[model samples]
Target: MYTEDLKVRFYETDALGHVNNTVIPAWFETGRLPVFELFTEQGNLYEVSLIVANLNVDFLRPVYFGEMVTLKTYIARIGKSSFDIGSEVWQSGQLCAKGTTILVNYDHKNGHSVPISEAIKAKLLQQTHPDHPLAS
Candidate 1:
């Protein structure tokens, strides 16, 4: 798993002084970056990157500005050409939200989905996470 930390921005808050629901998805992406980074020795490969096939999010608690948010990312499942990555946002060690991002490998030249390489598959499967979703 990979983790990324972010500070809640003032503008991200709603009238209730809590983070807006829409902002959580962007935060999830921030956390997903490092996981992808592990696959490429040179990060430049991300420019010709995979695309999201699906996204699932669950908001558990309210987040306020000035809170330190940590986003934990890991691969939950790996398929032929797609991978399911899970993430959760935390505020000072308290749970705030959780989600999954499904990315399908794509050929930049062909503009279509393709199978993930064996190197990437082996690397992702080697990672392990505790079974409990809430704990992760």
Candidate 2:
């Protein structure tokens, strides 16, 4: 699993002083940059052949502003033309949220989904969690 740590900023909080629900998805997106780099030599996120096909976020607990959180990311599964990234947001040793994003490998220039490259597929297979629900 890969982990990135970040602190909740003042601006990310809502009127109740809790981190806003909308902010967590943005965190998930940013935390995947390193994973994206694994597929592209250009080092640019936009240059990758990926598009979000689906995203599900479950907010388990409220996080206060300035609280430190750890975002854990891992390949949950790799399908023919899509893959799932499982993520967790933990704060103060408690899991505050969990998320899964399904990304379709695509030929953007051709405007259609495409299979992941064999090299990328192998990397994802090696990195996928053994116990992940869909990994097998």
Candidate 3:
């Protein structure tokens, strides 16, 4: 699993004085940077060969500003041409939110999905979380 530490900014808070629901998705995206690197060449955006197919988020607790939070990301499942990423946000040892994002390997030039290479699959498997259902 990949972990990232973030400080909640005041501007991210809502009228309820906690982070807005929208912010969690952005945080989850940030946590996926490592995974993105696996599909790109030297962190080049032009080399990205994947596209987000779906995203889901569940808020469990309110996250407040000025506090540090940790975002954990892991490969939840791998398919022929797509994969699911599981992510979580924790604040003060509490799980604030959890999410899943599905990404499909694509051939941008051809405008179609393509099977993931075996080498890349091996790399992704290394990132699977032990607690995930699909983890060996």
Candidate 4:
């Protein structure tokens, strides 16, 4: 339920003057920082790193440059060693695109997936959304 507002720059548009499809994913990634901070134990995004394991996006409508867009992010699920996050981009209150991403608990030093720490699991559980799908 966290939101971040982003401006649609002209350079983000394609030849048709519509925001490029690829840009939505980038927006989602950008939006995740604030949401992650809300439920983080250390109150910092730098304390941990989330690595994407899977991503699925759905484009609902076209967005033009010079528009103010709102990116909404939330935690959908938390697993033993992974988590699922959801995001939606809205232009003037209308959905432009929505997506879900599966992220793994990563050991940056080892460069491999690791189990979610108890502290992280507790924080994520505390922020669970009833209207959203949640998993372990």
| Top candidate (lDDT) | 3
lDDT of each: 0.81, 0.86, 0.92, 0.82
Clash pairs for candidate 3: none
How many Å off is the CA of 109 in candidate 3?
Answer: 1.2
Candidate 3 lDDT by residue in tens digits, 27-83:
999998899899876789669898999999999999998789999999999999999
What is candidate 4's lDDT per residue for 42-62, written digit by digit as tens? Answer: 787776667789999999999
What is the lDDT for 32 in model 1?
A: 72
- In order of appearance, the predictions have TM-scores of 0.85, 0.91, 0.95, 0.82
Task: Output the worst ten-in-a-row residue range by lDDT, candidate 2.
Answer: 127-136
As a whole number from 0 to 100, the lDDT of residue 103 in candidate 4 is 87
Candidate 2 lDDT tens digits, 13-127: 9999999999999999987787788778878777888889999999999988877999888899888889899988999999999999999988978899988888998877666
User: How many residue pairs in model 3 have overlapping backbones?
Assistant: 0
Residue 42 shift from truth in candidate 2, angstroms: 2.5
TM-score of decoy 4: 0.82
Between candidates 1 and 3, which one is better according to lDDT? Answer: 3
Relative to the true structure, candidate 3 reaches a TM of: 0.95
